[model samples]
Target chain A: MNEEKKISGIQFASLAFISRIACAFTGIPNLRTNLPTSDRISVFLIGLLLSLLLALPVLLFIEKENNRGLQNREKPCPSGIGRIILIFYAAFFVGAGILAVSRLGVFASGILLQKNNLHLFTAILIIAGAFCAERGLEPTARVSVLLSAAVLGGLLFTGLCDVGKMKLENLSQPFAGNIPIIVREAFFEACMNVELPVLMLLAPQIKIKKKTHLLLWLPLCFVCISAAFAVAAAVAGHYADLQVFPLHSLAVIAKTALFERIDDLLASLWVSCTVLKTGILLYTAYVAARTAVPACKKRCFFILTGALVFGGYLLLTANIQFFANVLQSAAVPVLFLFATVFIPLFTCLKNGRKEHKEVAKQ
Target chain B: MKILAIFLCFLLTFTGCSATVGTQLSNRLIIEAIGIDAQEDGFLVSVLALHTQQSNAANATETQDSIGQVFSAKGKSLSEAFAQIDLVSGLVPLYSQTRVLIFGKEIAENEPMQALDFFIRNYTLRESILLAVADAKASEIIETELEKNTLVSKNVQDILESGKNNGLTVAVELYQFVNRFLDETDAAYLPVIKTQENQSGKKEITHAGIALFAQKNLTAVIDKDAAKGLLWTAGLIDNDLLSIPFKGRTLSVAVKDCKSKIRLHKGDIPTFSAEIQFSCDLIEYNTDDTLLFNLQELEDVNRELQKQVQKITEEFIRTAIRENGCDCLSLLKKLRNGQPAYYAQIKDKQTDYLKDAVITVQISSEILKTGREVVKPN
Candidate 1:
């Protein structure tokens, strides 16, 4: 990738933020974590801190690899090991992308169309996402910046419209649930931060002017997510538990003198964000596949990754029962930890050992 | 060529490229209000829907029915009943514009969740839609013909809104009702509507009081005074009229501004203390004594007004909590917030907690200004 092809840190943060928002709007499928509604903010903040701690290895890897451009970096391990790692990352991104697309399909069928099957909508969104991915990271990052602004503005507008409806009586004491349950719920929240892996994969493509620039994204993302949950809890009160998508329900009830039933408009905006997230994921998968198989053309690998994601989406949507089971299982969080934390930590250790050997030889 | 292909894709996606024609607005029956009543075998659903064919100004003046038409159906379930309306009306029923949902006395008492499940589960209905209970059959209220060129649903909505503004009734929205219904510690309440005839023999919908629900059943119907007390403790009172008898003379005061705070003090059983500060302006007085002009006399009237307010507030708290065992004041919610440990211990015995819990009311009132006349006539 050329210098101009790389995106700025702000654009990268925006992409990550939008991706987290998409996941939140799709509904975090952590049914076992029964934290109180009012405790969601504190739980999410704790989850966010855990995610930041998990990203430390990736941050170290990025700083060490900063001097080496995307195309010039040497593998920390042997070529075969590097290829296996790349394949693992490719598989992880495809799985994450599939989940994102399937969630969008479920949301569309459940809320917007009120129909059982939304294959056509899902296909159209996947195709749009693939096309955006084919445009590469910089363009997607730029588009993410604009979409992030729109999403933030829409949330602020909804919150302001709902401020009068929010009652302090609706909020329960934070950490009122069992301490172990609260910790488990926070862990589940941290597991949903799949954006951490995406950040690691795209770090080489992001030009960070300062380390603090990278530090700003996690807090910003969690703040928005927690605020959204808090507002929904306050406005909807206990009624939020009855809803599959509380934010969407909140948007439905959110009315001003000017706009009535703004949920539809917000739903559209959320769909756009989901598509952008899927695009970024597909692009990252393409990058991994290209690195694993240097013989394949960039466009070919991109197309291959897109096809795989769409196929996975169709499979999951077709077998929604299985998909639901997968969401409830521990596989997703395990995969997230493996891809984001385990791999980066392994590479960081390998590089450190190699440098230590060189220093000892001198 | 790529741009052209993308544009074509966008066009097809946005337009939905369907072979069948979309349902036009005129062909769609826009439901404005829905009423549900419990029957022996099933449920009856009534809808006040806009008759798009007669939705013209000229047609509206011809008959009051032209403004909106009422349709009813019976089925084993609410979904079945609502589905039958489309068959009966020969038009697609659109619920996005629904303004109110009214439950008949039987359904409200028997099984409100049966009727509520449909509205709560339906994605088309807005959560902000007004919820009320009819004193009689919901269909009667839905079919009532008011003044010419007026919608009964709109009239009901306005009546509920007006009642809320005047602090006579609590205008419960769908979300608020569901929120309370789902909370184990809190009781749900909805404004009650009844049809009455005016002096000119015109039927009008009026806010009766408030219907309180314990869990799923309609437990009690509080009168206007009790409702006023509930509103005062909840800090929902605004511009309410209060009349006090002071030394054989009646003084009417309009509440200008009111603020309330409820605090929970933990003990073996939790106690709730409500502090209400209100300011009122004298609207009318029957007293003719010129001593009313004295500052001390005004102070005496203020103290009397404060006493009257305290009496109303305390009576409401007692009736709702001790007598009826209704936690409509959300005292448990306060306990949960202020004393979570005690709340958890008593959450299972919510009714017992309400019955045993002590509630104290404190009210302070300020008479801001007298009426336009400074002095009484000689």
Candidate 2:
């Protein structure tokens, strides 16, 4: 065991939470791309809550690792249950990567550039992301920390600059929409964001002080999700729902002194975040294959990167409406539920009972 | 060794072509301003494009190019007409830089939506782009260039940023105009601009009256008097001079920060109630006789100001809505959004919807100061 591994349990939870909260900005854009004026706040709140719920379980798993003797279990032949959990995590993270990259491309082009260059830019971004992933997890987490700071800074700058434009009365009206749609979407979205902790299983050999991770994870998740809502309300006001990407438009509206526009800065940050997120997912996928079949680790990195690069090129280049239709129907709900709900339940039952049996013996 | 060589070649191949492919400055002629006018043959389109220049700094200055090239084409459709401009100008037109859209009275009257479709569908165009209706040919206004700001293709852009508050001109952006079209009860009112040549060699633009559009066609034009009153009713009143009759004397009041809320009541006579709140400090008072300061007198002055404001608002609504039959106040939309059941009941009949709507005025005005000082007996 590498006793010197310094990643705290809280850091593990932050990584999962940040990665999933980033998805709220992505998947929610797809569901209500051109939402009407009245529904903006509801959709924004739904996006935030759904993302937080999806991010919580991975947070729980990482917190419980030390007590279960799961630390330093990386080198040995992985148990059948652990292998399945790792595979599901890889799928969830990769799916999130595709969605995030695509959404970034759509929003950057649609609002900031106001041009039609999704194909060229998205391919370039995904390729760069895949290259970063081939390096390793430590470098990727470092990038995540940098990207998180940039995103936070951009949000604060836009909020402070556009102080006069926001109207509290505009948001005074209670969220008006179908409750079923809001509740169901929020639950499914929770699954989408929380699944990032499963990837930590590959590098789970890095142990941390227990229980403290949960405390840090929940607050960071809550703050990030709540900030997104506040920014949407402040920038868009009555027009939030009418916008395709409220955050992107809000940045454009924040025409501050000394800077012509902060929207471009936001796009640059998104590109950086997307790269960090993609790198983490691809690295996890590489780790999963390595754990399942140890003989092919070196070859697998290039294979997974190459395959993802091609997939990204095709996905971004294709007509936007085709993917938009596919995403809305069943593909998103099915995939999101499978990872956030089904997998969490299955893992909890298996891992929970194992810990219970061990506790009984004690 | 063979597999490694094959993989290296493939990697080089993907990376090799990626760098070589560079974006050539698209032949796309970037349109700064567009004018749409109804012609004998469909619509005449005029686009002002800055002449091609290699230097980026040229665009920021007035003399970027020798002259901003003007291209005009006439066809049944806006896209078709614009495509013809490409034939003459020999540049592929771009709409990303488009700032202002000018509509002629004929086009605004006959059909404004026909000319608007091109802007709506195009992803490159922004919904925040300003919309203006011209008194005459929209081409004349676009062609008039400022002596200093020579590359000024967008005339309305200058007016919206600098124009004094005029009752005649109601400046509405593309998004707000479109919302009027989408909402069944709300009629659109667009600001009108007319061009005048100045002897000082500086181009000038004046805001004419507002052009009202109902069912996406111009119903009538509201002249300055009705426009001013309508503005007061809508609570957009700013820095307006109001002569308030106080007891036996008249005081000039500088009104500021006005807001109103309208409520609809159902029954035999559909009464519309409006509560208007405004802040005004006394600017000046002129009278021959000396006045005594008393609480009853102050209350009387407040009541008199209230009655005067209410009368003006009612007259304004009567002219714009009752006479012209255009609901710019969106009494219909308010009913639908606020009271849906009432909206349904009156949805079928226009008379039921328009006839019953009434205006009720409620105002709370605080007099910060009664001018500089009170008149002492001398």
Candidate 3:
């Protein structure tokens, strides 16, 4: 007597592309300048491919589960899939939230607000996002769509404003840094961008039926990648090899009669993006965990762990430099393995079983 | 009830922390000048901060001017010195608008790198703050009173900027200083300012020369002539006067647009070829020439002047690289960043390698305009 909605193929691709672009833009600038440029791009591509592999199995199985439920018609459908999806969502959401909030929050303080005001302002934003997520996924997604547009617009406007500062000759030599350095650097950058597809944990729920979905999502991902790369490449140039943050350095070069310092604006944008990004990831963690285990109350868990997680974030982030080193060197490799390895392995097993069941029924 | 109480406590704490001060305490302090001198133990820091006072209109005359307080302290560390000085001053010293950091000659020569490290490490200090070496003493230079010393900071700023109008002095900022110091192949130099007693009883600041440092350590001081030579190599010479004898008469031509490039080559011994191209406008002439000169006359003058500039700049580079072991031209950094393999091999033996390096200078000139043709004084 009830109609259950389905997420189409277009929606899946949209989720994949959007996730890729958002994460990539956030991390590539940091990765390119500090580490070897070669390592930066290489590691990012590796992580991205790995994420795709991990995501494929889960995507196909979800499709299979839908097909199986339709075919049976008589037997009650298994209720455990939501629980499994929820578990993946939980780990992903929390890990991403803690990482993004703690890392970007510190950087935002340095770039935007005065030192004393950084913590207070960032904490206010995080609290607001956490409260908003409590309302549910629909509101979160709607807000994300609005936020993502605003971020993209801001990025375009900033790029256009700073376009005159760009010297084309700076990017003359591509991958000028050492090969080993580039690979290491690429992995560091990839850590930032590749985690985006983790939003696929929400794959089962989005209503992506329209044919126009693929057209919308695929180009969006490319545009995000292009703009971020352009910003890093143009700003750093030959001097990029020397400085820590080339994009920020380029932001310093921005001179307009209206404002002498545009780096402050870029820093503010980073803060806003980080906030929405953390909120989405945190919600995903809740959803994924709830899907995997029917007995667990996901939203309640979010509420319970909120203060503890925040406290942990504070304690762990005592030393900003140490936190950055850990994020760049340790956290990225682990994230790459999970997103690229673990998910795919599980998906293959689930798909193989579903195939076996289909043959047996036939 | 407990949760409500806890929330109320948080609210009260947050509200209690709200400040009423219109401006931050740090903003109140206006640090005009910073003097760094090396003592027998460590460093002697002297800071000139703004001292504000309220004057009654009855006492205030038409020529009422603003005056400032100068505070000095010595400590083992810069932060410690800052803390010591802050105690004596009513307001905290703010360095956000700090115009100059003058280093005494002894401190510059003995431990220039250490003084640079202190500024680089401080987050509050900006990279754009001008770096200068005091010819005599840091305190003496800051205390020197000049004509219309109403805005001493503005006067110093104008002097440094005017250096760009000619090639007499070299201007270096904290960022540029640190950048060169950190860069293995390049050296940094700062303008030297000295206090001198003129004909009158007044004390004045004079630009002595440029203090050249190798690997962030002061190796030697290049006098005015040598500074002019170095500026020629760096392509920073704008109003340089070239006196060339033609037809047994001396002609002075002022340099206008200029470009310099040093290309490095390697063989049994390393070699560097320097190319400088510039345009000049005739400013003065000994002969009373009423008519405008043709292209050939200008070309001849240009060729002779090119030879003169090339001879000096080439000599300067050779002496700086071979004799002094200085890399102030930043050619080494350019080479290192442009070619890593070459840098890796020659980095250790840079001074030795530079001695063996052959340098050639080539100059090209284009005359833009000659002075107003003084009609023959008949």
Q: Which candidate should be chosen as best, given TM-score against the real structure?
A: 1
TM-score of candidate 2 chain A against the true chain A: 0.78
Q: State how far residue A29 of model 2 sits from its true place (Å).
A: 4.0
Stretches > 4 Å off in candidate 3: A1-85, A108-118, A131-182, A202-259, A286-309, A320-332, B1-27, B51-67, B147-150, B197-201, B236-254, B266-270, B283-287, B334-345, B371-378
Error of 1 at A247 (Å): 1.3
**lDDT, candidate 3, residue A193?**
44
CA lDDT, every prediction? 0.79, 0.62, 0.60
TM-score of 3: 0.76
First chain TM-score, candidate 3: 0.74
RMSD after Cα superposition, model 3: 7.1
Model 1: per-residue lDDT, tens digit, A62-107?
7777634222354543287777877787788878888898887777
Off by over 4 Å in 1: A1-3, A28-35, A67-72, A75-78, A115-117, A298-302, A356-362, B1-21, B56-65, B246-249, B267-269, B286-294, B344-353, B369-378
> Candidate 3's error at A72, in angstroms?
18
Task: Report the C-alpha lDDT of model 2 over A306-358, residue by residue, as the tens digit.
Answer: 46654764675376676567556676667766655566556666768988999
> Relative to the unseen true structure, what is the C-alpha lDDT of residue A227 in candidate 2, on a scale of 0 to 100?
62
Candidate 3 lDDT by residue in tens digits, B9-88: 23322311122124554445677788888888877888866544412234433434544557788988877887888887
lDDT by residue for model 3 over A38-133, one digit each (tens)? 224344454445444444543554454553321121233325553443455466567667666666555443433333554565466556446544
The DockQ-based CAPRI class assigned to model 2 is incorrect
Q: What is candidate 2's fraction of native contacts? A: 0.03
